[model samples]
Target: MFFRSSKINEFRLWGLLFTLAGMGLMILGTSGIVFWGQAGKIFAGIFMVIGMIAMLISVGVYFWAGMMSTSATMLTCPECSRQTKMLGKTDRCMYCKTILTLDPGQATQHPADTTQT
Candidate 1:
């Protein structure tokens, strides 16, 4: 059946937060050098590296989500007759609470493949 869009949205939100946090850390690290001397410079360098890595990972995840979103197929919910996109083998209608499945065999065979059941 349908799963909550909140999970994917949450991941995207967290990725954004990480990206912003990384940028802020990088800036703070660079700015510290003017007043803090060698120690500040070293700390700033460390922050910069960590921040860059975090931002890179976030960017990669965002890109992946984008690709998945694009590949998701749009369908009408039989339960509510509302339209929504299906990701993977199963997904829920955004407007309806009905559990939708893309694969009929999954519902009959696995029964527990919630994605398709």
Candidate 2:
């Protein structure tokens, strides 16, 4: 639970970072950052392209995270007694970082998510 939560948080942060980077790159490319007449213009175009790609990738990552949220299993942490969502088979308590599982023997019997969107 904790691990999955942490990863989700990281992914969100990374998406924001990538968005910022793309904006920065686009700004730099549009501004007079490079000076070489035609060559400068070409460099700026390349930067713009790279920035667009980064923005697109960030959007995709965010979408993927949102989709995964629908299937997450929620459970109350025994250590911290707080509710948290588990993403994968290996999850920990988000509050106390305690390892959590469905069941030792029935670990493989975890239900598949049928919830859509």
Candidate 3:
């Protein structure tokens, strides 16, 4: 719940962060002209280029997430009674954060189990 989310959501979160960061960088680049007059253009260009790269990376991440999501297992969360997507053999409920798994062996393992060892 605190730091857990569906794989798809996690990817989306990263994409959102990248997008925000890129936008912020671009804004900062534009603002350089106001702060440094003519010399700011060089800094502005460099920042803008880096920002574009970040945005491109974000797009790639989003695309990868979308492709992965299409093949991910969809299940009804017992705890939340909501449909959620799960990646790999185990994942937590996106809404309720209840541990979920398709394998019987993994199903018995919980967050507490990891903390003990």
Residue 14, candidate 2: C-alpha displacement in angstroms: 3.1
lDDT of 1 at 84: 75
Whole-model lDDT values for every prediction: 0.75, 0.75, 0.88
Off by over 4 Å in 1: 1-3, 6-8, 31-35, 77-82, 92-99, 103-117
* Predicted structure 1: lDDT: 0.75
Q: Would you list the clashing residue pairs of candidate 1?
A: 1-99, 2-92, 2-99
Candidate 2 has its poorest 10 consecutive residues by lDDT at 1-10
**lDDT digits (tens) for residues 1-117 of candidate 1:** 123652345457777988998899899889879779877989899989999998998998788877777777888888778777777776656665556678987654454545753
lDDT by residue for model 2 (1-117), tens = 223454455567778888999999988887644566666787789889999998998998898777776677888987688887777666766567766777666354566789999
Worst 10 residues of 3 by lDDT: 108-117
* Top-lDDT structure, candidate number: 3
The model with the greater lDDT, 2 or 3, is 3
Q: Give lDDT tens digits, candidate 3, residues 6-115.
A: 77788888899999999999999999988999999998999999999999999999999999999999999988899998999888887888888998776675445545
Backbone clash pairs for candidate 3 read none
